[model samples]
Target: MKINPLLVGLFLISPVFILLISYPGFSVVDSSEVFQVFKFTFHQALVSSLLATVFGALAGLSLSSIFDSKKYSFVESLYYAPSFVPVLFVVFSCLNIGNLWQISFKGFWGIVVIHVLINVGLVGALYSKILIHRLSLMNRLSLVQGLGVWRYLRKIVFAHTKKDLLFLFAVVFIFCFTSFSIPLIIGGVNSTTIELLIYEKLVVLGEVEQALSLALLQLLFLVFFLGLINFTQAKEKAITTSWNPFFKNKIFLLVPIFSFIVLFVGLWLSASFSLGWFTELALLPTLIKSLGLALFCGYSIFLFFQFIFSILPHSTFEFFMSVYSSPSTVLIGLALVVVSSVWWQGRWLVLLFGYVLLYVPVLFKMFVQNFLSSLKPALKVSRAMSANYWLRFKMITFPLSYSLCLFLGFLTAIWVLGDYALASLLLEADSTIALVAKNLLRSYRLDQASFVITIIIFCEFIIYLLYKGLAYVGGQKY
Candidate 1:
């Protein structure tokens, strides 16, 4: 039976509908308090996005110099590694470093610093790729014309990449704006973001109506920004060029490198032999539960994407998925809570469902969309040849994209492993390692928290290897 893509889109978006339908009558909330939260949220997000974009652009320009070299291929990973891991680890590392240096990583500037560190690498990596792929020819011609590096960058590079930079800025802004965990951990009382406010309203104050109102407001802002920005992916093109000395500044590379060093070093410095706490706290059960949750979430995300692929080349559905933003985290968790309260033993199911919904769009934007776009020609030809949907997916799509799916799955698993925001809302007790780490951090037990984060990272590495092995075996089978 042919499935309508709209139905699939509805399935993906059902949680939001549940939220709206369950919205209780409006309750009076402090307008001035919300206004202050909004102002701070907007101000911090703006500053963080601008700083991240500038640093990212600098790093990207520096990276473009070595883009043609196979020897430095791994350098790109450095720029992305900071943002790839869960924000919890990043927060733990930052706090650890702060403690070591006797510096405060709390409040507005602290939040901005963390945001910049987390995002600069991603911005740089994307910016570097954009330069190499989109402006390689322009770069070569400008160099040959004896154009000064500064002038060429001002006239050619900035002109070409401003829109891309703006897009990245918007992305970073949204991240910082709706950020729950980072702000919750590092943000001081005066630095509370709208997301944190929502959390407080729901969990601390038991103000469900006020929380829903705030969540809706946040959603409206996201929708407005998303409407203004057209997220068009650049087409991939091969460029062959020699190394240019002008773009070879290593100073900019240090941004991402230093960020990476800070994380590991801080973790090392804060870590102690905490073997006693592990068994005494019954962390083994939580560890096992976390690993299972990660594996299950990863597989679930992979399967969801596969299902999306099975209904390929539907413009309406693709467009819907492209524009649809998952509800804010607090909103999603609240909706699940409402749903779970009605059914017996439905908490885990709804929690898993919430995670899949939250992350599917993220993975789709990062990797799946481009991969799927590349297959349009093949999919079209397959359709023209009377190939059934299953045949097309089996013969053409699955083989080409399964590895990517596996990789995305691995990423999903890592995110889930480090996730505490949703877990804190859904589970009554600390059921995962991330929650345990969070509690330790909150309790001023930095050493124990660092040790727990180490275990989480180790779990991530094991999952990565498992995924790699699966990809290898799948490749051989295909």
Candidate 2:
């Protein structure tokens, strides 16, 4: 019998589908509370997105003024560093920083501050590249016209990138809205987000019905925003030049840069002072387990997506695959927990399997194009030689992108290591370093949590180096 590729793919996500079908519906009494959560989530997300975008735009413009185009790539990476670091660590760092100022980073303002810090760098880095490229096109004509900086910015810079600015706002809004770790950590009872609400329903209240309802609502909201936004934008190449239009106003750029430096310093001081954390035996085992889980999840997600993308034709079916990746991590974790009795053994395997399921969509979105490009030449060679399916896959397909596979594995592994939402639902207290650190943070053991976060950062750097090393050895540019 022949099988449809879409049907086969659907079977993989049958768990989520089952949960949607089995939902007991939303309760009338809970409507007001649910609406309150929704309101809070929307308000915080809106404020955070607006602030991050403005500040990021300023930082981007500042960086463009001070740095040559040749240094833009380095600048981009430096700014984007915070986003890639573990969310838990970032939250912990912010909390430590707040403590120094006698500030309470535990409510609406706290949530906003952390979200801005985490996302500002991303917006700045991405916008800087585009702004700098536009800088090269300015030349002396625009300058000779005596177009004042503010007037130039208003008429030229902002006008030209309005669409991108809107897109950036939507992107940041979505990220902050669905944010898990930051809100989960610092968001007290009054400021709980929908994502955290879902976790509470499932983990604390055991309200599967309510959890499912909340999950569906969050999913619908995200899909609406995501549909309105375009995911794919043409990436403009970086223009390498020595020209600087805003050289006189470089002072403004230092604010965001200095802010980031202060946050890092606070995190460093917290970690460095916790010298006794190094002697804990529990830390070692926790690290090893987290490492093992990360490796397993990463390679599994890499291979799983590689196979699925290869088999599925790039059509509407491929687009449908990314839907599963959009839902909250806590939602997916809860769904798996509900259904684990039927098909899962309640072991770490369930967590591993769930990670692969959710992570595939993410990896698919990231690596699908790369996979297709790599396969084209190999498939051509195989077809010319009249190779069989197995032979083509074994000899040509896999070999061409082996380095990419390893690199993706490394990337996903790092992400899994730092993730707290999914692991929160599935793993035991001492199962992973992130979990342990989060628990410590919850218990107000700041010193111990800081040390754990430090180790996690150290592990991430090592993994990144390995990814680069593999790419170099395989003759692939990362």
Candidate 3:
């Protein structure tokens, strides 16, 4: 029997709707408190998005100039390394760096700093690729027209990229607005964001109604913004060319270099590098469980994407999925908590369900839909030839997307392995290494937390190698 991807999507997202409809009337929350949290959330998101865009644009410009050749493509991955790992690692890296410099990272500015660090690479990589594709032809035109650098940038470059930058700003703003783990860990009391506020109400104060209301409010804002902005990548054919002279300024190189130095150096300085404590804590079981959970989550996401891919080129479904954002982590955790209570032994199942729901939209937006979009022309051609769905997928889709799927699965596993926010609410105990590390950090054991983070990094490397091996083996079969 054929399954509808849209129906599957609806079922996955039903938890949010379930909470929204089942909300038992309105409960009064402090108006001042809600407003205060909202203000901070908006303020921080604005600052972070703005700073990240500026730095990211500069880094992108620099990268486009320096790594213009195909041989330098692997080095480009360094710019994105900070973004692919879980936020926990970024937070610790920033905190350790702050300690090294004797600076405090415990308030509004700290949150902004960490957010910028996490997003700059992503924004940079995107902007760089866009510039390469969109500006290559324009660069030649500008030079032939004898356009000065500043004038060309203002009149041509900025004009072309303004919409793209706005869209990126909105994307970054949304991420910062809905941020959870970062604020939960480093945000001082005065800097609590709306997400953290919801967590406090639900988990700390047991104010279920208020938490649900806040979550709904957050969702409304996100939907409103999403409705306003339609982000479409430029489809202009990439012009093969030499370096754009305007981006040849070597000073812009500092942006990515500085980012890399801070993350790696901070990790090096902070990690205790001792396995004695790791063994003493008897955490091997927890580590193994976490790895297993991560592997499961990764495989589930891969299969889900495969299902989505099989039913390709559904415009309405793709549009909706592209704009869809999951409800707050706290809200999802609440829904699953109630469900788990009824199912009793289904804690793992519920946990996985939540992970899928939260991550599917993200992966779809970032990778799946893009991959599907690229296959549309071929899909149409296959259909016109009266090709079967399975045949088309086998001959065209799977071969093209296999590597990306493996990479996405690997990334998902790493993220799940490092996740603690949702697991904290659902699990009865600290069953994962991430949760244990979080607890240690909360208890002010920085060294121990850093040590655990190092272990996570090692595990991530091992998992990455395993995925690479699987890819090699699978490739041999094809």
Candidate 4:
């Protein structure tokens, strides 16, 4: 019997679609209030995306010179630290520093600052790679023609890197637009984004019609941004060649680079580390729960991806995969909450199912191209032999990508472990360590939360090594 791939894809996305279609009749109870929230969301996201892009460019350009001087490892902390550490830790660290300076990061400006701090390093790293990769040609042209700094920037830097700049802007914008955790934690009720509104309607007020209406509105924004991302990616591909190793002596760049490093380290130390908290003894349970959830999410999502890939046509697979990036986490989480409200007993199952739906597209986008390209020969051979789909995957595809899949699984698991927003709605505080940490912070248990965050960071480091080890072992064998 044949299966319809589109149907399968739709089935996979039914959770999100249900949220979209389940809207009751629209009632504009407070259209003005809702519109105000919409305006706030738009303004904050726009400003955050713009500032992040600019700061990222500065950091990236500065780091490029350092990389060229072969001091790349010296600033690896600044380059990679943001991603390795959980976001909440970063948020708390910033809040802590603000307190030290008597600054209140309690509203719109606070959200923007967190976003810029979080995204600046990413943008910088991107620029650093691009600059270093093309440094030789650029340097030669500028030096030979005696182009001044401004001219070189205008003629060479902006000309070649604008696509990258736009790409970064779009990505950061989407992130800010759909932001849930930062806004929820820092923005308070009045400063909530549309994504937060979705959560409020579902979890706080049980306003299903209003929630669905807002979700549809958010989806429209997502579709527009995703299209923008697609366009920018295509344009980037057309213009971009890839990055590193160029010799340019720009000492001025180091100032921004060092400043960025200092800012991050200061925040990290101030917020996440405190002496004498390790002996709390309750730390182990949180660690275990987080680890367990991560493992479950990582492996389940991977298995589901394999299942989907084996069944769907490539086009259909891509279409379904794109849908993954459509809804924000809060949106997806609330949808799951609504669905689970019906069965009541299997909310955990629905939560995990939601995890797969929400994150599979992410993992798919990350790994599919590399995995598919690598397994092409084996896949072709299996197809030529008329092997069944499962047989083909089992005999050919799985072996080739097992190590990679394991790595992806662990990565996904780490992300799940770090995640507080989605888990906030589904599981109790005790069930997910992230929730525990989040609550600890809210309850003014800063030292304890910091200790917990420190543990989470350590676990992330261990998982990172494990992921790299798997890749290394796979490299040798495969």
Candidate 5:
């Protein structure tokens, strides 16, 4: 539980990555070009995630409808298959399909379609499930009263739908806004995203200061928007997610069937009806690489969870509130002095640590809340027993939480391995499989791009299977 001095320095210096990356002068940056560029980036991503969410909702609705319960289960499983597949795979699949339709995958609209198709499955799946559950519950009452489905939705469905729709749009905006791989791969010079620009300035141009500045600038903008969303949401009435979803409508029913036709057509154009994709020997190496990365990432995430849980028993707000408020730059200075005295020289490790801090809020919120839910009752029981912290947590908490924690770790890693921002920090390493995949696109080798994407899809399916396994196991434990 002891804090390492080396980690201390890295956490302190994290923000400088952004400050260092900006162009030399804010004086000149004020020209309309900067504002225009920023506006373009924001609008494109906003539009994309929104559309993706609508499609995602439809995607979920489509599968959840039409099919009977038994067959719907199968369709539901396939409906969500896209979220795991890498964005590049989606792009290449688009490219292959485009050749037949004469559709070009090179512009803003084209990129949006790929992002929507690939990621909407999650929004749809979750949204649909919630809707179906509610609908089933509402149906019981409606059937008794002889009220119609529309009446139920207008009263109940609308409320639930609003929350999910808002949430889905917010998330879609963030993903598209921050996305690197998909935009960079399919976007020609005409379609450069802020991430690509950051990469160009920092990695390609070696303008670390400018890149850091831009990165920081983008972060600030995101904080501002996020703050506004929070403020607006706070002003509104609080609506809890109702664990119910209904989808007996005709429009919702035919959606997944139509989507399947679209998906099938894309797959057909992509694979070109060749069983070669099924038999290719090249898939093995890429698969091995993806599996290795997923495993390491998964394990690392679990270790991190274990480390945090052991070190801090208090709420994360209580734990980080003290440290986060302090200017990290000052802390880094102290950490640097301590490291020097200790003869440590892992500056790169320090950078990695900083990124972890930057990304911690999202992942932490997702897992820590889950962790705490299980801890509350145990802590209370310990209170009754007059047991000390370690005694109660050791016997009750750790064992009970480790499996779910492992499952959390696995899901987090799968998410991280595909995480563009996290992977961006470590892209220089030989183990940068995502970077290697990006490089495949760089070479403009469509066939090679095809290979990388095929492998990505396979790896995702494995991860998805593992996640479902974890979900099943976790469900049983509860």
Candidate 6:
């Protein structure tokens, strides 16, 4: 696998450039204030995840009650829509309407609402599946005798779902905890998160040492949670190869899908004056940049997956614990590994590390990481005696990781496309599509911004389809 010169260059430039703008100095070290902020971010996320999970579970359970009805299928699609949209669009649409009504999307509570709204769909979707699985299991048991609804839930629902629920909570909590844009845009001084604060330390404070300190700290927190998750984690679920096809009966299910369409469409029409002017502008350059960053972001996921594939034996979660027990552990661990292996030093590695930090948890909570981690241990033992790098990877790593690398790569690519925070920090003035999207939005060209967003998402959908095709050929069986 020859490295792409452009990707290497971009990776090298993105993080290293931070050193130029970043302030390496700090006012007196307020370990106390930093600790307080740390405590607050976790506290808020815990509240947000718990409350949101309840709402999400209720929302998901509502779907279970509605299932087999023609209108029910639309429910999941509606729940999924917000999760797919860029957060900025949601914030803008909400703010546009709220302004007309003189309501505020500001401070802590507002941030929580947005977090819940964004994450509930994900939580709801997963819970719906969990509920559906429970229902199916109960159906199997009903052949012999009736289990009361409460008994069914206690024995089958809760009994079989310890790992799934643990996975969901871990996910929603980390997402809220590390969240950046929603909090940054609407948070003002009253709302903050570890991700936003890291941005502050790096971009605002210009404190490199402190920024790195904070980044290191954030990394440790994530690894800690990752470790806890692995402790409770169960065996990996095999990926379902069959796609559920949409049918005519599912047409009524479009109610929620249409509900979603109507909502966003209404927002678009109401904000037309803002969006109209944008639709007329030349977006070719910005389109190209968005595509470039998006492509590069996709490429980044593949490379990071390689790194993930590198440390297979001890669950990455377990390694995370061993590595983050001390900051020196991370510094030393990398030193003996990738950092010392090459001449490179700086933020590209950090940015790549950021992507790992970015994807691994969400993916872990989603169970993607766990699956990847599961395959590599046996593969690594095979590699220990292999004669060549490619031979070892091809025989042991890639084949074992066949389904994961492809799916995770594509899923993460879609994710990285919507990544505004990482793009904001790393991309040069005109290099990033997200920056361009934000530029358009900031410039009041809402329509063109929507166009750009649509195009980006369409590209992601297309890329994912392509990856799915390749996944079929791999014979690894997803």
Q: What TM-score fits each model? A: 0.92, 0.80, 0.92, 0.80, 0.71, 0.70
lDDT of 1: 0.81
Arrange candidates, best lDDT first.
Answer: 1, 3, 2, 4, 6, 5
lDDT of each: 0.81, 0.71, 0.80, 0.69, 0.55, 0.58
**Candidate 3 per-residue C-alpha lDDT over 1-478 given as tens digits, one digit per residue, 9 for 90 to 100:** 3556688768767878777666766577899999999999999999999998889888877777774465336446767777777778888888888988898888999999889888887787777776776688887788788898799879877888886777677778888999999998899879899999899999999888999989888988886776566554433444454556556665665676677678878888887977688787678999999999999998888777777777777777877775677788888998888888889698988899889887777666555643564678787898899888788888877776777778778888988999998899899556899898888888898888888888888898888889889899878866
lDDT of 4 by residue, 283-390 (tens): 667678678777778778667666655654465456445434656676677777778878889887787777776666555654453355446656777788998877
lDDT of 2 by residue, 137-239 (tens): 6634457788887887887778767756766777678778888778877888799899888888878987877777787778777766655554543333344
Better of 5 and 6 by TM-score: 5
Total clashing pairs for each candidate: 0, 0, 0, 1, 24, 8
Task: Quote the lDDT for 293 in model 6.
Answer: 50
Candidate 6 at 285: error in angstroms? 2.7
- Please tell me which model should have the higher TM-score, number 2 or number 3: 3
- For residue 111, give model 6's deviation from the true position in Å: 1.3
Model 1 sits at a Cα RMSD from the real structure of 2.6
lDDT of 1 by residue, 277-337 (tens): 8897688999998999889999998887777777777887766665566677988888888
For lDDT, candidate 1 versus 6, the one ahead is: 1
Off by over 4 Å in 6: 1-36, 58-80, 97-103, 127-139, 142-144, 235-267, 270-282, 303-357, 369-403, 443-448, 464-478
- CA RMSD for every model? 2.6, 4.9, 2.6, 4.6, 6.7, 7.5
Candidate with the greatest lDDT versus the true structure: 1
TM-score, cand. 3 vs. native: 0.92
Residues 305-392, model 5: lDDT tens digits = 6655554445434334222221222222223333343444654344334334543444553235335544666667776898765775
